[model samples]
Target: MNHLRLFLLSIVVLTSANMLPAGDWPHWRGPNDLGAAEPGQSPPAEFSDTQNVLWKTPVPGRGHSSPTIIGDKVFLTTADVAAQTQSVLCFDRQTGKPVWSTIVNTGGLPREIHSHNTHATPTVACDAQQLFVVFNNHESAQLAALDLNGKILWKKQGPFSPEQYKFGYGPSPLLYDDLVIVAAEYEKGYIVALNKKNGDVAWKIDRPQISFSSPVVANIAGRDQMLISGLGKVCSFDPKSGKQLWAVDGPAIATCGTLVWQGDTVFASGGYPEKETMAVKADGSGKVLWRQGVRCYEQSLVAADGYVYAVSDDGIGYCWNAETGEEMWKKRLGGSVSSSPTLVGDLIYLFNERGKCFVFKTNPEKFELVAENQLGDEAYASPSFCDGKMFMRTADSTDGTRRETLYCIGE
Candidate 1:
């Protein structure tokens, strides 16, 4: 089904229970934006090009952004260096066919980016009515809202210049009720929340530091606060008021991983000038529950039960008690891993840079590998799940002639 038809059908079936369907990955991680797949739906443990692979389609340009799914359509962003264009692509969730591709920006870049980072590093977010995308257009960052049919509803410019981040931008927009919050952490940091209806500035907070970590919202102490880590601190802000509730100083500097929230505690890790992993109280007390030397600079940690799991950039998987910071188990999964693991039921799905997909049990007792499968030549972008299907993006060939592909695995 096309996007327009799906939107119309959704309006007719719009009930309290069906507002956000169980099988819609509306954001970077998933519906909850916490790297959790839909319940009762299991993607295959083993899949390859010819085994359990539903479909494989060629993506047009280079993108480190992951796929976002809403109802019957999947959304992703890509940038073509030669053409100097950045685009938002929509594909049919079932058929793996192209639905529409909308160019959101044109012209060359304003500054040089890191070799590993692309201009389209940020992932898109979606709500019931529209899709929100962030593009670093030349000097200014642009946030746009588009209908399901690829029509632009509104567009607003962010607060920072691209040149501020010498490396590049990697933060994705966080969508709450009727606001889309974007973080621009350069030499000077600012969190801007735009009105989703008409793209006006709703609230903005200024923090002077460089960061690449994305913000996540969690309910703690009967309030919803947005969490972001960088510049020697992990701060919590009132999502509705944009007021700083509390800030904890640490050894953080330019963090890449997002925080993992479980119950009344949240775990955060950062890499670069400093290496530290910490679990902090989430009740606005600014108390550090525990601190450790373990770090996941690039990939985010996943918390389940009473434990948290993280795969370092060098491919070492560590499971620790979420509250005590004691190590439960540590094992090595070969090859570098930048993609965060997705938790489904009791199994954790981890993909390495070499395209090796590792399925293991999220056991706090020991490291248990259930299955290992190879999918592509290289994959840095994380996977998304919806309706029992898994979507992955792979870009092979480090040279200019890169072959970017999107794969759908199921059954």
Candidate 2:
């Protein structure tokens, strides 16, 4: 089916369950990439490396990607550095026991990546029946579909060369309807949608140089548009035909975070010193409502209750009024932050690179730090919250010492 038809069909499927209670963190940045959890709930405020952890599973290899939890299963990807193997690991959500591990076919090539980058930066997405994963092996990139039981259903490899960045490919794939959207922006900047059932090309559009940011799907002006940021530009496109609808230039920093949207306004930010954050009106014509500069990177924005919250890569957290682009307040967080901030009710949870997480109030007038905890390692992967628990992953240190601990933080 074409993308338009698939989108229409998905609307039907989604509406029937719209009223049903939903709480699965099935992909990056949670459901719909909004970063808002269920209201009136929070992660445990006082958990150390060993305390308040319901379970800790040692994942194999190394990866900075976050975990995606559905129903009773949790899915993530990791790279075997010495063996040159890329695989997906599935674990039981309740017990943290290994269910299965599927080795992905990376073709015949030596895996080339930055020392800090891995082959598993993209988080997997899934529906009720199947799971999807993206593997970039330097020479080529491939997207694979597998059954819930680990059987490979289909695989599609790209004919274009892999794009080289200071880091590796960090853009995760987004699934909309029956198509899987993957951003190949390095050697050749393009956004292509593949048939989810058979891995066929549904639509492809060539784009300019963009950074390692993922694309988001949203309803703009009664039409469905894919929002993407990179190459000093934030643009929207028709998902079915890849037609550019509108765009606005941004800062020079490589865009590495998800865009946050509330009603008709979309917010994006990146860069150091003076990071640029803008609230653009996505009303089919793409107008800038307001723009502000803030220093943030690699961290996605979270919107809730008319406020947008973000933590800078240098460890500063700020809350902004969503409608008017007014700064509420800013707080100086002491650790470096790479993961995004997730809002649960009136509280904001921020996980930092130094293995510390800070809990603060999501107030619009001032800053309030409620609690702080440490993990005793480096954390690059964002936390996944589901069923009143937060899942966190950390990077291994130098000297070949691997630490693939998955901590389940709860009360």
The global Cα lDDT (0 to 1) of model 2 is: 0.76
Clashes of each: 0, 2
Q: Write model 2 residue lDDT over 1-411, tens digit each, in one string.
A: 135433442342254211222557777777646776643346786787678989888999878888888778889998876777889899999989999999985444334555646778889887667788988764556889999888999988874354445356778888777788898776566789998899999998875563678888777567787897767777888877778888887743477888878777888887532368878888756577767777566788887667788887789888888888888888789878878888665667788887888888867778888889887568888888877788888754554685778778887
Q: Highest lDDT, which number?
A: 1
> Model 1, which residues run further than 4 Å from truth?
1-19, 162-165, 398-400
RMSD of each: 5.5, 5.4
Lowest summed lDDT across 10 adjacent residues in model 2 is found at 12-21
Which tens-of-lDDT digit does each residue in 70-179 have in candidate 1? 88898899998889998999999888899999998888454688777888988888876788888777566788899998998888876556444577778898987788
Give the residue spans of candidate 2 off by over 4 A. 1-21, 106-112, 159-166, 251-253, 272-274, 395-400
TM-score of 2: 0.90
Model 1 residue 284 CA deviation in Å: 1.7
Candidate 1 is scored at a TM of 0.93
